[model samples]
Target: MISAKFRVQLPEGIWVADTSRAFPDATFRLLSGLRIGEKAVELGEVIADDPQAIIDRPQSSIDGWELLEATDERALTKYETTDIELYEFVESSALTVEFPVVVRDGWYEFDLTGTRDDLERFGDALDEAGQPYELQSIVGTTDPESLLTDRQRELLDAALQAGYFEVPRDCTLAELAETLGVDKSTASTVLRTGEAKLVAWFLTGPKQN
Candidate 1:
């Protein structure tokens, strides 16, 4: 199977037109979900760089979504919708994908492993449904290892070469930062975020379809 990554505009993406308009800085990270009879409930995290007063009114700030929990960095919420094509796309395509899917700014970015025919089929389905989408990109495969950003990849490569991940730890964070020409904190964040994404990549599953 081939792996492809692309961003498409989906009208079925309810979050963008709904809550994001209120707070442009907040991004909804879908974790998992369940069905309550006819309605559905999604449990996910909301990261807001400019949190503003949204957290204070979590109970009512979001429209369709119901805030079930909150923390300093993110908020957990539940909402109901009947968009089966979307939830199904997480697994339904001949492609294999992980969730919660990345959706924001009026688009859904999909990273999936499948064949070209599979992508065409999915796109055709979208056309038939009258849901217009922009195909952003297509690549040959995906994995936990392919998720790293350039800076993160550079730092990881440097760290590995210097034995930073080794038990004895050949290099310090400062040394790695210096090697990459970045500050300690910058290097730390790149490595940390990259590591976290890799961990999440490994642990990804339990789709709430």
Candidate 2:
């Protein structure tokens, strides 16, 4: 199995897109959704200074909207929408979506987990449909630690202790190499490879066996 992160451009005419674009500073998180025929019922939350703006915004695609809860900084809402292109596409594909789907700056960012073949097919479908998307990362295995070697783990731990990954790195690569008693080139290769694995692991998240 493989997990991938994708950032997709919101399709035109979708209420989520319209609202998100209208309130660029606000964050919309789709907590859950259910498709009913050509429409969909979604439960979501908005994080913004004026959470009421989302409730006040008039959108033609939204058939019904109800505010479930609200605070100064956030609001929970349930709404029915006629725009279900993305939802239908995911339903037709073999991929499984991991919510809450985040919307900000006119983009929908979400994670998908599936077999390699399923992911390839979903990518092909997106291309055929002319949907703009960015594949952020892909991890082959769910067990992140399993991807690292013993030596790599040891070096990464040492680097962490030395603050090599800090904003203003406490130690230089040469310094780390010297401490590990290895040449700079070997240390560099190991660190680079190990870092890539760690990043991929972080993106995909660890799954239970």
Candidate 3:
């Protein structure tokens, strides 16, 4: 499979309002979102230096949206529900991909993996939906690191977000295991091996080492 990343500018909505004000720097991992009647229901979290602001700050949607629920932590997991029109647009568009979509600075950034045809279809979908997007990066061939597998990527990504690499380590090995519903040893191995492979891949960079 091939991978690509893009930046999408959604139409005016709550996300636009919130990104402009309350959490300009907040990073989002959208877990689930869809249109429910005249409004959109979004379930996601803010991953940043300060996550509490996301939960406590008041939201403003020029169009229309309602913050149904939010908590101080676990913003990604807990049902931080909201009504957002952007969610509807995203769900209906070709730009939709499997990877968790990241919203920050009022733009949607995401990585997608598929064949060339799939990517072409994605572009077509965006065009059909009238959603303009900027292609940030594209990988046409198989990534050697694709060997890491989907589960490994998810585990490593979660660990990284949980501050597993911090000096004090915000999350313990056991905590990571609990998050992934796996045993401590399994989590430890996933973190260790994932880090090693990712670092080696980065050191190798564009040219095959």
Top-TM-score candidate index: 2
Candidate 1, residue 204: how far the Cα is off, in Å: 19
Instruction: Kindly give the number of clashing pairs for every candidate.
Output: 1, 0, 0
lDDT of 1 by residue, 65-90 (tens): 66676667666656665544455654
TM-score of 3: 0.52
Task: Show where candidate 3 strays beyond 4 Å.
Answer: 31-43, 48-50, 59-77, 80-96, 142-176, 179-209
Report the error of model 1 at residue 71, Å.
3.6
C-alpha lDDT values of all predictions = 0.61, 0.80, 0.61
Q: Encode model 3's per-residue lDDT on 3-121: one tens digit a residue.
A: 67888865565544455345676677764545566664444556666666665555553233334444554344333235455555545543343335677776778666555666777
Residue-level lDDT for 93 in candidate 3 = 47
TM-score of each: 0.51, 0.66, 0.52
> How well is each residue in 170-197 modelled by candidate 2, as lDDT tens digits?
9999999999998665576667656755
Comparison by lDDT, 2 against 3, better one: 2
Residue 138, model 2: lDDT of: 82
